[model samples]
Target chain A: EDQVTQSPEALRLQEGESSSLNCSYTVSGLRGLFWYRQDPGKGPEFLFTLYSAGEEKEKERLKATLTKKESFLHITAPKPEDSATYLCAVPFTSGTYKYIFGTGTRLKVLA
Target chain B: DVKVTQSSRYLVKRTGEKVFLECVQDMDHENMFWYRQDPGLGLRLIYFSYDVKMKEKGDIPEGYSVSREKKERFSLILESASTNQTSMYLCASTQVNQPQHFGDGTRLSIL
Candidate 1:
């Protein structure tokens, strides 16, 4: 069975303070991993996707790195607007594109 | 931009009432998914469809059903609304082995 777990359920950071969120998973064939940002009262917005170990992708103030068993979303000098729940997901290995998602890390960037 | 649109942003219903949540994607993607979001639990896939008239049960599919009468639209149905079923519902669409695009979500409350 594929499973995903995220740590530190929530985090509070001062503006411009950097931090990292973790997502660990157990699955077969490791199709792909994805990161998304979800704001309050809204659906998740796609962020990054990593397909192989040691792969990394970055967006403004956010960088995602993936290893064999885990993935990290690093926030660099985050701002108040960067506060949101970060979710990670992996595709089902049974030839379906269905995703199994993590509980997510709720980040609060205080100004 | 790929647009996934949910039928409602907020909905209220009573126990034993039948509820329908609709999602439409203009991108002509062949995959669509329905998920429910709750605190401390990540997106739990309720159902998904890969093509017209095709549907698959996801991680948590009890008390729910889905329809995919067309390639661009999917509908999730709650046979009988319950208080425990009150949560945010999200809709997503994508192509084969690709990242998904999400709608704004519908916050449903059952009384």
Candidate 2:
């Protein structure tokens, strides 16, 4: 079974604070790793997709990095509007379009 | 912009009642998924469809079923609404291993 785990269940930060969220996965074959940001009372918004080791993608103050076994989401000087839950998912190469999701890390940015 | 839309922003159902949650995506994607989000569970996949009329059970599909009769529309059905099933339901669509675009979500409550 494909499994995903995320660290730091909850994070509180002052405005302009920087931090990183971790997403680790164990799967037979990794096709892609995805990061999403979900706000309260809304669905998740797509953030980044990391395909291969050493791959990285950035959007605004968020950067996502990928390795063989894990992915990292780095927030640089985040603002109050960046407060949301960050979710990570992995798609396996077993010809299934299913994605296994991590528990997610809730981020609260205080202004 | 590729947009995904859910039918309702909030729903209330009585116990033992059947409920349906609808989702539609404007993009011509090949895959669609339904997920339920709770406080600590992050997002749990209820079902996924790779193509029209093709459905697959996900990790937590026991109490839920899905229908994808059209390429742009997917619906999640709850056989019998339960208090435990109350949560925010999300819908997403994608092509293969690409990142998915999600709807805002439907908040369901069972009385």
Residue B3 miss distance in model 2 (angstroms): 0.8
Task: Tell me the DockQ of each model, to 2 decimals.
Answer: 0.78, 0.88
Q: lDDT (CA) for every model shown?
A: 0.92, 0.92
Candidate 1 per-residue C-alpha lDDT over A25-77 given as tens digits, one digit per residue, 9 for 90 to 100: 99998888989999999999999989999999998899999999999999999
lDDT of 2 by residue, B28-62 (tens): 99999999988876788899999999999988998
Tens-place lDDT per residue, model 1, B1-111, is: 899999999999999999999999999998999999888777888999988999999988999999998898899999999999999999999886678899999999999
- Please give, as one word, the docking class of candidate 2: high
Q: TM-scores, in order shown?
A: 0.94, 0.94
Q: What share of the true interface contacts does candidate 2 keep?
A: 0.97
**Where does model 1 exceed 4 Å of error?**
none
TM-score of chain A of each: 0.96, 0.95
- Which candidate gets the maximum DockQ versus the true structure? 2
